[model samples]
Target: MTGTREALDTAPTLDSRRRNIVFVTIVLGMLMAALDQTIVATTLPTIVADLGSAGHMAWLVTAYMLTEAVATVLAGKFGDLFGRKLVFQLSAVIFIAGSVLAGFAQDMLTLIIARGIQGVGGGGLMVTAMALIADVIPLRQRGKYQGAMGAVFGVTTVLGPTLGGLFTDHASWRWCFYVNVPIAVVMIALAAKTIPTVRPASRPVVDYLGIALVALGVAGLILGLEWGGSEYAWGSPMIIGLFAGSVVLLAAFVLVETRVPEPMLPMGLFRNRVFTVCSILSFIVGFTMLGAMTYLPTYLQYVDGVSATESGLRTLPMVLGLLVTSIISGNIVSTTGRYKPFPIAGAAVMALGLYLMSTMGRDTGIWLESLYMLIFGLGIGLSMQVLTIVVQNTVPYAQLGTATSGVTFFRTVGSAFGTAVFGTLYTGKLDPALAAALAGTGIPPEVAQSPAALRALPDEVSAPIVEAYTAAIDSVFRWVVPVALVGFVVAWFLREIPLRDSTRARATELGEGFSMPDSADRVDQLEHAIAQVLRREQRKKTGPPGPSVRVLTGGTVPETLVWAIGAVHLRTRVRGGATLTGIAEDHMVPVGVLEPVYREASQAGFVAIEGDSLRLTDSGAQQAAVFRRVWRVWLDGKLEDWTFDDPADRALLDPALDKIAGDLLDEQSSRPAFAPLTR
Candidate 1:
């Protein structure tokens, strides 16, 4: 029992520290994953030559892409179920292990398998990082942090290829894989030390069927695109079968999600207008961005004959544009608390940039290329952070993780599909251009026609093939420009609602008894008093009432009691024959309280029954209203200077007014006047 108690006492402290650690670990892990995807691009030629499998070169990248795409949605759901810390830590371990395996791989096939393992871990890292941030931050403040994260993403993209090149040139290409090991180790250690462990709110049942269906759907679609025109013709049965399978599985996944008690992807989130619109816009943004970005390096290397380093350098303008714009836009959103215009403007700018880039050729100026990239980056930076903020604001805190992950998942899916379709277009156009370039050369058509055979040729044969590659890639951007324009149209529909910073605090204050200095408090008091008066009248009319009525003044009646009296009078008048009056012959009490109460009741059309001898008709009630209003104003001025500092005085007066009011309002028909009020 002592051991158990000690363990329980330390658990909360341990959990708190662990949670912070987990967050840092996840951030670093995500950085590693994102960096690896781009960093390896610069080193791919070296890797292909080293492994002696040039024909299977694209598989090295495709394997990772396929696994990462399929794992993101699954990991998101698991994080919500098992606790984000657990999934995040597990992802780090998996990523680290995959990195070690890839570093030790002897051939391209082995390296591809290792990358696939890393992709699974990479998917978890990205999804869980987003979901965890949503858990810790309030929605209103989330935009600033998300902007900071976007800056980090931009930094990674800028540095990844550069870092990879440095490693390949200075060290060995294997160090690229080994590099993640230390980062992962440090991240895991810090996470275990600082990351807090929040126990799941309720035990979550794994949606095995839903998971399987979604995975199959995404996997089939990505596989079909990745291999459709490259490994098999577009008209091949394999492509058709995979496409059909993807659609069927996606349909089943939707059906399962809609029926589940606690769904992984709840349909209810789509009910919010902002969430739905932002999600669609996020998808389009990702689609347009990935489609164009995927081929820019190819264009530079093939068309301009630039070295890999030079190609990366040419993309710096876009990175600079993203960095500057995201920081400025984030601060503006934080200060102004508005976000609608950013997306619309960003999409328009991106469309313009895409249009400009599509007009590029073999001899396009380097400055012009940089300008187009800068414009595209600026547009992306402005809109990306705002989309996450919009989605987060529209949902409850508990659903933040789910909603965020859902939007992110769609974005990733769009990126994957966008890259695949555009790659197809580039290849489709390149094959013909290559054939035309090789026309009438004594070289056989079969050798010139094949990418592998063409790559093996001398510099003379390879130059034209490279030129064809550039022009075909440029055609892909032509299509992307229009897609970005469509995104602008979608962005235009995003509705802007001002974020409420103190929504929760306001709700709490209202739940308590605090009231602001306004007529609402006074009116509320009157309503409460009227309710009490009606209840007493009701009991008197039906039950025994054994109290004598008395005329009293000079007291602060409980606000509720006053409202009850007003309510009773209003109800009595509405029922067609009742009246009330306060009889005071000599009193020094302020009349503000009773005057307003009486005036309001009369205005509501009540007759006054005063001292058992004076009764008010409609005209008499109207005549009394003028005196009531004038006396209330006068009494209020005098009462402002008066103070009931003695608790005993307040105690005695409060109960006295309550008793007098209760007894008077309870009388069904009689209105008896006691001794005249005295100061």
Candidate 2:
């Protein structure tokens, strides 16, 4: 229930070599998760033909999607509890297992069940990968990495069908599922070796009720959408009942969150105007973007007379636009720390692009359609990629995991709804239009549903169906224009906050090295005083009879003792930079001991490592200042009841204290008067 950053002295950081390995595994895992969403589309026909289950084809995706959505919310909380490395590893194992099951499926039911299981693991991998980056990378440098991740999404989304088609056309469609197995094996191997076991200082309490309510609510809503008009009439009692139950459940979820000690989705975060606006914008961007994307291929395939693979290629302009803009915007935000303008402009462009799409017809040229798509992609790129950053920046460090997951979860929900709503609109418009188009022709209405049949029909007969299809797609996009416009309006209200600086202060407040003279005598006295105070604090614990929970520091006070402990880990002689061996040589310490210490400093929040240079953290520096003051007062015989009436006293005392502290620490010690390490 408590919210706190890690205390100083135990500052934690992974070495760069390890950090890079973690990043690669995360990227590949995420790519695998992302690729599955689209890859199945190309293989659906082959799957249906092989399994003899046209009725079950859509569930192949729907089951995966429904389960994935639920898992994403839980993954964030689990990562915070179980540790990202373990959660990530488990997710991979499950995903690989699901993939294996899917590849070996004997029936449509088994494949659908396997995909749903895979979705559960995929969801964990996706969110944990994101949260893990926040765990390992310094915030200021994360933009490029986040940008690259976005580019991967854009690329995979466009390329998924092509990859799937290659597997289906040449090998068995089972390869699509089998491919993830090898990639996942590699991810798991690298993960176990490289990903840090970042266990939390305390175990978290799970809100089972809150999780259940949200899951049930979302499941009901999604199921309603999935079944309405497609599986059942919109007004059918079953669809109506699902929608009604979802509303009641969601309302109960909101009410419960307000009462919970640790809510899965904290209602209080909505108070932050930035999070509110960004979340709204995030939802709209997902809604319009995903819906538009789903239908564009339909336009290309039917109206423009292209193959599925060719349809994907034609959508490349839009994907590339999104890719280019995401990278550019990410770099620009990193350099300037300004981001509000991009989302605003991007939303506006997206609206215009959606509007432009509405104007296309059966005769529209492929190049011109691509031009319109490029504009849409530009808009999506500018806004969607940056939403995660803006939300992360607005929340407290304690809430980072929740806030990050929240935005993503909302976007996912939006994507699901977008597909349903747009699908309904497209179907409603197309059915009537096609029926009328084929009225006098010898062609059955079923012919209009089949691309091959429609393509082989006489020109007089096919032209009207194409026109009807183009019109239906135009109508679907026309509805999306307003959603994009709403986002544009929301973007104006998004206030930009300065991104947090890249420092270990947020990591730990413990000071790095002792700056005072190596005066064993003075340090001895100061250490005695600190130990006495700490002993008093530890004796004052009021909790239950169990393992005594020692208080290391005050809520606001940085623990000077822990800083001293962290400083003891430092080997001598690097002012700014040195090779590892050089550092080890200077202090006559083995390189192995120093490596772990450096990692401890990095993670403890005591020190930050920039390339070869290690620097003290803000709190670490503060602790050091306190050390100087402690020594200055003691040397002046003002230790018992000291007070500095004038601010000028610090300047007078600091120089004297440093000189005295330095002389004592370096020359005299076989061991310090007080060995924090031994303690």
Candidate 3:
């Protein structure tokens, strides 16, 4: 009861202007987090120059993504238990601290550690921002705003590399990290003033052990791959120990999930064929996207003699291709509800793109390079946009949170693994090749390795070294071709199923194509899904009249008055009293205007005017209850296209419908448009 009271106390009371401001505040937070995902791509070569460990460079991106992946799962649960507003603010503070630390770092180790901290905060901001949207925005308007957020996500993905390069070339490479500080600081201030407090209805079980096991197991495996031939011998005790330890820990994680009351990832989800196949495809998508983004700039700078800024700009073909196709594919799926062909075609294109990229050499034309990149990105867009939608369409409502997070988790891990493996292959090939080419040339090994220094040498002296860098990078793409082919083969096994109406509606948002981790419970997700449909239908303006519109209120009774009665009953149930002035003020409407509506309701015998408070009479209460049922029925009808195979799903869905009905009734009833009950 106290929990419910706290939620009521902090419930949104924002006017439209203030709500928009809150939306902007959270959007900024989300932008900062997403920006970091690709911002380091162009800066990697420069950072390696200053820090002197090119071999360990992949860890910069890996550390950030790995920690961010773990943090998203933890933050989602924590936000649910504590509150989204508090979590969002704290995440901003942590991000600021991490950014400052990273900017001041003196060595590769220190920079990597700071980046890990940044990842944790960035992950928190992303998940909490999504949750906060459900808190402040009205249900009917949420979909358009969500679509706008997705658009912002797409823009950042294209712009991140260029922005990072701009900071590095004009200011200092450190500015790439320093740039987050002021933006995050402003976000925190705006969040404090504009965002409403939203308390959770119940405490959730935090899977601390499960998260740790997966994090450690994954990190250990990545460490073994990263260090195998570079830091240590392949057969060394340290490498063998790491690989062995990871297997034992991962096996233990499986056992722990089966017994936990609430696991981070439920073992049961793997039993479904679609979930298994989609997870694999998601991994390949991450592998290709991040792996190329991480190393392409290196090849451009080292072999092609391009500036870091130019290198970033040059990557735009790929990003633009990804964006255009993502939006187009999403719309197509929404219209036709058929999704299997996109992944199959996407994987084949991806394999073709990789094969073309592996053919690049010092003499390759710039146009050819861009065309290859565009092909690769197009493949990613087609395959990625529908994975989450299909998963949500197929999974039971009870497992929605875990299932969504699980797919995202796999993608994040794949990104980390991809970066690590690329680094290993590049390093392994580069070292021996560089030594062989530089032998007896009297040029220092370190000087030949540095891009700036190598370019300073005469062509006759630098030609061999350039060839080595070109061949080494080409080897990375060559190795990854098999991985993409595997994804292509797996994509063939994905079975097409009918899209739930809610899922079809949701697929129109391009953000799903980016596959960012979203952490929300089943009810919040359902509300969002329905909100999407509501928005789309609102545009067509063609749905049949609502079931409740005619039957619940006779031709004589104003629909507005029915709404007023429901609000009164809700306030009385939750807060013990409801005054006309209180309801008017909460909605930021004029008290005098709403007074007549209450007076009319009283005259109709639906409410009693007891001093300053309004109380629902027996008839009023029963009428309110019936209208709520009407809304419940209307909502249930929207999901008529979805299947509920398990009894447990219905058990979870039934209560969720009741809560949404109460919400819709209260929110609709309180609007100023409904002030004149007689109308």
Q: What is the C-alpha lDDT of each candidate?
A: 0.58, 0.64, 0.84
Per residue, candidate 2 scores C-alpha lDDT tens digits across 25-130 of: 8899888987886677656645654674443445666566667777776665576677778898899898998999999998988998999899899888876776
Tens-digit per-residue lDDT, 575-669, candidate 1: 34332322211122344434554555445444343532224556544433332333334323322322345566345334333432332232322
TM-score: model 2 vs. ground truth = 0.69
Q: Estimate candidate 1's alpha-carbon lDDT, on a 0 to 1 scale.
A: 0.58
lDDT of 1 at 51: 71
Better of 1 and 3 by lDDT: 3
Global fold similarity of model 3 (TM-score)? 0.96
**Runs off by more than 4 Å, candidate 1:** 1-26, 44-66, 69-73, 76-86, 104-112, 127-154, 172-174, 189-198, 396-398, 435-463, 502-679
Q: Estimate each model's TM-score.
A: 0.64, 0.69, 0.96
Residue 235 in candidate 3, Cα distance off native in Å = 0.7
User: Which is the better candidate, 2 or 3, if ranked by TM-score?
Assistant: 3
Q: Order of all candidates by TM-score, from best down to worst?
A: 3, 2, 1
